[model samples]
Target: MAKAYRSVIEASMAQNDSTIDSTIDSTVDSTIDSTIDSTVDSTIDSRHDSTIDYAIDTTIDSTIDPIIDSTIDSTVNSTIDSTVDSTIDPTVDSRVDSIIDSTIDSTIESTTERRYS
Candidate 1:
């Protein structure tokens, strides 16, 4: 009787140990797999976002910078031309005409004085 009871108890203990080991192994495997998958997915997503942002920034700079520069240059040139035409040209013309009239009057007066005297 004593021998049979000992054998039965030993068998039960062995079965319980095997069950516990199997459970632990299954839980550990699932946890490790999920953790690795989550880490890889997060890394990939971050890199992809960075790549997209860089490409967009590069494209915008390449496409829009030249157009902005051209517009600024054209506007500046047009403003300068307008200013010269509206202000400086007329002032210069007026001065030139006055000088010419004064010179002509002086020349005529000098000639008349010489002829009469």
Candidate 2:
């Protein structure tokens, strides 16, 4: 009877040890897998976001900047040309006409005075 009792107790202890070891191994494996997956996913997401941001910024700089600059330059040049044409050309032309008229009138008056004298 004593030997039979000892054998049963030993078998039970062995079985309990096996269950404990299996549980610990399963829990540790699950924890490790979760941690690694989370880290990898976060790292990949961060890198992808950064890459996309860089691509957008680069595209804007390369594609849109020149177009905007050219439009602004064209507008400013056109405005300046229009202002000069509208404001200065007529003023200059009027002044030139007045000078020419005055010169011609003076010459005619001088000629008449000489003829009368």
Candidate 3:
């Protein structure tokens, strides 16, 4: 009777150990699955955020760059053309007209003198 009781107790302990081991394995598997799911979700969220940021930056740059370039071009062209017209065009015209008038007068005088002589 003592030996039978000892055997039964030993069998019960072995069954308990197996049950504990199975519970531990299930818990570990569940923890690993939850960790993987969280990691995947975080990675997807990060990628989506990064993509959105990049798109916004690209759109802003594209929209603003042309306006800036056009503004710079208009300013530089207006400044240079205005400066040249104001400073150089009138002086050149005045000098050219003076020379032409002088030459015409001289030619007319020579022609009149030859005709009179």
Top lDDT model: 2
Q: Order the candidates by TM-score, highest first — what do you get? A: 2, 3, 1
Backbone collision tally, model 3: 0
Off by over 4 Å in 3: 1-50
TM-scores of all predicted structures: 0.54, 0.58, 0.56
lDDT of 1 at 105: 94
lDDT of 3 at 72: 99
Instruction: List, residue by residue over 28-101, the lDDT tens digit for candidate 2.
Output: 99999898789987899999999999999999999999999999999999999999899998899999999999
> Candidate 2, overall lDDT?
0.96
Per residue, candidate 3 scores C-alpha lDDT tens digits across 78-98 of 999998899888899899999
Stretches off by above 4 angstroms in model 1 are 1-39, 100-117
RMSD of each: 5.0, 4.5, 5.3
Number of the top candidate by TM-score? 2
> Tens digits of per-residue lDDT for model 1 on 22-72?
999999999998987899878989999999999998988998888888999
Q: Can you tell me which runs of candidate 2 are displaced by over 4 Å?
A: 1-18, 96-117
Error of 3 at 35 (Å): 7.0
